[model samples]
Target: MPSTSDQTLENQNDEELNSLHGKIKALRSVTIDILDDSNRQNDQLDRTGNTFTQFTNSLFSTSRHHSRSMAASSTVRQYRTIAYIVGAVVLLWLVLKLWSFGGTRSVPPDGVNGEYRI
Candidate 1:
């Protein structure tokens, strides 16, 4: 059997409690929304990072292939130059040797003073 004044005070306390509860619920809802937005941002960042990685990988692979092709082309050119140089040297040597062998005059068929004629 509470007095009227005590009952009024209890009612005021109950109203205050309800008000605090409502504020707590509103804060919780706002916090949840913020967390959800943060998660979405994180997911988007992950996707962007993956896409960048893939692009870089492709670029690197293409560059590697190009480098290899250029190296091969350089090697072929070097080999061809060396072959041409070697062939030219060999041809010059053969021509010089043949000229030296063929240029010496042999003894003439008619003898003059017992010496062969040029």
Candidate 2:
């Protein structure tokens, strides 16, 4: 009877050791899965950051081009206004000179109030 009881105790110890080993294996698998998920999340964040940087750079470039174009257009407008002012001044001077002539005729070269005609 004592031998039989010793054998039963040994069997229970073996069963408990196997159960503990299986539980340890399950914990290890769970830890590995968590690490994989973390790595994946970090990679996704890096991609998103890169994409945002590219978008911002493109937007900045477009705005710079537009600003330069607007500055050139403003310069052209200023030149056009100056040209118009000069043309108007010239026209006014011509009109004034013509009015002074007053449809008058030129005197003949052959002596009008002269003692001798050259």
Candidate 3:
């Protein structure tokens, strides 16, 4: 049979080992929870990244289309301005020519007496 001192030491050793085992199990559970949380965060980050990329692509395409339209509109406006300028110049030239030709004519004898000049 074992002595009293030996038995006491054996019991102490068993208690220490049991405590260590319990601590190890608790640590394993905590590590598993940390790993699960990390995986969830990674998934969320990927989704957010994808959404941002799509939005950026859409914005770029819209801006490109608007720029093209604006360029076309500006070209049309330039043509219209040129046409108006040319028309005004032609009208002024015609009016001046007509005025010079009409002023050089002689008046009739009936209109020279007391009637207003036509």
- Model 2 is weakest, by summed lDDT over 10 consecutive residues, at 109-118
User: What's the TM for model 1?
Assistant: 0.59
lDDT of 3 by residue, 23-118 (tens): 999999999999999999999999999999999999999989867866778778767867999999999999999999987646554644655456
Q: For residues 1-118, write the lDDT of model 2, one tens digit per residue.
A: 5698899999999999999999999999999999999999999999999999999999999989867866778778767867999999999999998988886556545555644333
| Candidate 1 runs further than 4 Å off | 74-118
Q: List the global CA lDDT of all models.
A: 0.91, 0.87, 0.90
> For model 3, what is the alpha-carbon lDDT of residue 25?
100
Q: Is candidate 1 or candidate 2 better by TM-score?
A: 1
Candidate maximizing lDDT? 1
> How well is each residue in 2-75 modelled by candidate 1, as lDDT tens digits?
99999999999999999999999999999999999999999999999999999999999998986786677878
Using lDDT, rank the candidates from best to worst. 1, 3, 2
Q: Estimate the TM-score of every prediction.
A: 0.59, 0.55, 0.59
